[model samples]
Target chain A: MTPKISRFFAEHRPATPCLVVDLDVVESRYQALHHNLPSARIYYAIKANPAPQILRRLTELGSSFDAASIEEIRMCLAAGATPDRISYGNTVKKVSAIREAHELGIDLFVFDSMEELAKLAEHAPGARVFCRLTVENEGADWPLSRKFGTTTTHARELMLRAATMGLRPYGLSFHVGSQQTSVTAYETAIARASALYRDLQDEGLDLQMLNLGGGFPARYREDVPTIGQFCTAISQALTEHFHNDLPDILVEPGRYMVGEAGVVSSEVVLVSRRGGAPTDPRWVYLDIGRFGGLAETEGEAIRYTFRTPHDESDPDHSPCVLAGPSCDGVDIMYEKARIPLPNSLRDGDRVDILATGAYVSTYCSTGFNGFPPLAEHYI
Target chain B: MTPKISRFFAEHRPATPCLVVDLDVVESRYQALHHNLPSARIYYAIKANPAPQILRRLTELGSSFDAASIEEIRMCLAAGATPDRISYGNTVKKVSAIREAHELGIDLFVFDSMEELAKLAEHAPGARVFCRLTVENEGADWPLSRKFGTTTTHARELMLRAATMGLRPYGLSFHVGSQQTSVTAYETAIARASALYRDLQDEGLDLQMLNLGGGFPARYREDVPTIGQFCTAISQALTEHFHNDLPDILVEPGRYMVGEAGVVSSEVVLVSRRGGAPTDPRWVYLDIGRFGGLAETEGEAIRYTFRTPHDESDPDHSPCVLAGPSCDGVDIMYEKARIPLPNSLRDGDRVDILATGAYVSTYCSTGFNGFPPLAEHYI
Candidate 1:
């Protein structure tokens, strides 16, 4: 039987080397997340892939937005998301951006240090703020303890300073890290935030919100936990901390909401022999690269499946290395993957790389080397 | 003493996160290569950032273009480079690209296989063809021997087939590898090409050009060999192979032409405590990341100098890890590097990343997580 992907390809016939989003999957994922994490307010991380369609769907699903820049704020607004629903989440923001956010009626901003608070106080004195606390988790896949975020001591100082400056310090926020494999990291971050929240309350400042910044991993590989499992962990953590009575819980999920809903379709322009020694193996170069379909899989090797047109019976799978159109050797998508292809696979063949939605389109350097991205399509 | 880069930043006030090009250094580097290798024709590989100003300057300096796609071909043309001076050097030829090349009057193209030859023959019969021969270099930074070129045996067959198809097989081309630190690798590739050139003549075929594809390293650190040293080796190799008489030489240099010319200027957005057992180390997070200024430094650690605004003297330097605005922990630029800055460096201070022109701009994922490139300005 022909695969569902093949049928989608037949109907859409997207431009080669282009990103395609399945709106059905996107809506289903959004609905599922909302159903599971009913207490937590979802803020679509606009940085993932702020394509209009994806933004529209998320906003339509009643999700707020997490924007990092003026342009991202503009994109969210253009997609009909209100300024009140959009949080300018960059820890260190420019003065101009602070002014712009104020003018746009954007109330919420993230501050990691006293200097940033000073800037915010001078620029947007009345803006509602979230003290971004630095959660130190060395065991997590990404250790965010070294980057942007305030320590517990620093977080208290910043929160107190915001109150002293006549600004509304709404709550606390912390991100575990992107593509976090461990669910315990979220629980630990929430536990830390809970302690910070209580300490700030003890200092006589009533906080209204606690942002558990999104690092909820989408199931890129089979071994990755499902979104249901992730939501359950968050639920358990929330129950332990607030005992089912919490401030407005916020999550800035970028990849989990949209990553698996997208696919990149590219045509095989040429299938030719790449020379190698008898001992060393060869590669089959494709039209996409680290710049295109495989931006997320940088540093490590990944596997992707492919097949030829017409002869679609999982054509004798073989481990072939796939490279992009660029001359750079590092411009590879898969280091090695057992892709199904016909023995006579030649020019004009097509391949669909599954689950490319989140960062692929948004991160593409289309103007690089003068190669613009192929037009994107949504279904 | 003030650095040469100070002037460029003066005119374009080091926008928090942007790329700056020093044209004086770029032109001098261009002239140095031309002065060293008079007999060899130089083609600037536009795949490494194809910025309009850079292209225009290189073209003005009498450098032909090595374009991989029709888009690059068009960019070169728009930059005032004539089509005859552009070589469509990608081995994988698309039918539309072949037709576009023909329409644009681009005569030179490369192919590694007979299948590609047949397609090109059908699309553009009168196109001047070159067969890319695989150069076996055991010791190179990145071995292209396995990916792009055809084997010498297969190359000969492809050349013969091109002759039969009524296509003019003009020359042979091979890339040893990108970032080739060894000078001997070029000689090895030349020696291989020399054998092929001799065999083609012996077979009664007229070959007019011998393309030695570019892998010339731009000196990032002090240890890299000078351009004059590389040219001396190439000069000696040509003298030994052709006895002072050889085909018109073609060298495609991408990084060497523009790497040192560009600098990415970014601001220190946040500095947090990191990577220590509660005693010492801390990582500084900048506005740039693996996605921005450091995209070219893939797989290897990069050391870049950062200076405070307008204050070069008595710079306070410290080793710190840098990260981009993304929440991903892996979105790091320098995992660790000593950056020079004044104690006044707060949230708003700017830092300049030197030698970023080569592959940084071209390889970036612009919309990744909805972050667009920092506005770019050419001085």
Candidate 2:
């Protein structure tokens, strides 16, 4: 078991389905980011796990923020982050939100369409704005397809509109997608943004900043290159693509900073034999389910590694389908995960779901089907 | 616009992505159920929409509760529901949840497996127990699948064990599935349960009740047989199958009780044309999405009817893909819903999603990516 989980249970017995976060691991991850990408400013995305303790810890680390909403901005400010260090990263936003952010002295913002640009102009004039460029975004576990960014031509027009609307066109931004696995995805995205930056300069709009959006992968069940490897690839790409001059760089790391730092401890409610056939998947029900904060399972598309009380060397284990404690059938966590679950596992035996620090609690439903919200206990 | 929606916006200008529930409509739905199935008892599943105002109104309407957790039992009691009127409906539960429910005076409980029956015997001995029978649930908008219920043989063994363990073998329950469209699905399931009920009686353990679990369809985007049709089919099936005698009838209607009684009022965040070709779906971003209380959309598997400010017959509409304001690509509500969107529809225009009272708020994620939780405004 991870030391944090042991520490959590040792300090005090908690109910089933509790999130245990290791603050020491978080600090180490933050240090790794700065150590590798010395040229890039770090902005911690609060959406992954917005616990106040996490925010306070990051603020103490001198981390900036890539806030997606006004609530997140307020959270960052409350955690001691300066207004200058916060960026309104969401392209799609309300006019009132724009006004409030500007009122709070948040100048840096992002937009992708002229519709949003017009709203910004009417709501908060003369604010620093960045246009998001659409990327191919291949090899990402969670590909950010049509939901964000815009076509290159549309982005150029949006930046031009930003300048005309009296808004300072400060930079260009692009995301390679969340949990992006390939190093080449960033290289290609950087090259595209570099070209756009030079082209905007030709239009007399020389953007001085480049916000390489968050896609930094976390070490979940699978293996990902170290943060240092990702940073080195990005650094080489910047030197090769921007050749003459490098713009001030900013990176938003949400999952990568917290995913490995937390573990979810849940109890098994039932181990029922369903489907009857030996080839059929056995159903293993838990107190916490998809709505109970393990939603990233997303129809079991993201296979998280599972660990039971059995020793790692134990050869006896069972493969089973995992489900949550809700009336809705969609509350399934894993359709068929080949985890080393003990055959002797019964009701009340705790199962450790590793690397669930990010996206679990933040995406939790509020007491669906009489199941209470997933409890979070930070150390 | 729906009358409740207009009245809601008229009375109070709430924030975007809000759920407006009409208690008067809920009362009407309750009366309809009573008029249609006088022999059957109604248990409103609190998981559908557990707004306190809703629970209180239902309590005032003399609606019994099918609680899924101890928290739900507390909510029902707080709303003035007697212990005898409540049933612990969820099959999968923790030991503590069972203990607390028993402590709170709830006795009617449901189970589908020996494991859960054992837990109930240990935690809440001598309590009334109902075994859920697995059914071939077809024509359901949300199929229960393998998450609940058990094989006929397994259920029989469970009931016999319940009697052996000093628990009252009260009934046999089967869910034809939530939002089940076909009346025949219930008829088939009821016939199967009736046969098993007779078999259990042969074993000297006569089941006293048959819970035709929640499957009653609601009028969502499509048409369903009226409550009268469903009731007649069920009533006829019970008489025809049971012949000599029938147990007390119980019906748990979740979505049917409140789906049409509520409307979701959300604002259009962005209306942008992407993908280029006529075949490419236009993207319509909304402040509300799957995470924003409309999770029943189920990755566009469940389409909700929408209304805009445009006249119903302006011949000016577009088929657009709907997405939430979050940066995640999976925040899409619909891939292609042919909403009657005005050609002039822009940011800040209101769009009313109809028949959203059920499953919406219950499955909503809390403040994902800084987007606030869906606010409920009851009329």
Error of 1 at A136 (Å): 7.7
- Judged by DockQ cut-offs, is candidate 2 incorrect, acceptable, medium or high? medium
**Candidate 2 local lDDT, A36-101, one digit each (tens):** 998899989889888889999999999999898888999999999999999999888877888999
Off by over 4 Å in 2: A1-5, A275-280, A312-314, B1-5, B274-281, B312-314
Worst 10-residue lDDT window for candidate 1 chain A reads A273-282
How high is the TM-score of chain B in model 1? 0.90
- For candidate 2, what TM-score does chain B get against the true chain B? 0.96
Tens digits of per-residue lDDT for model 2, B217-237: 888778899899999999899
lDDT score, candidate 1 = 0.75
What TM-score does prediction 1 earn?
Answer: 0.88
Q: Could you tell me the lDDT of residue B165 within candidate 2? A: 97
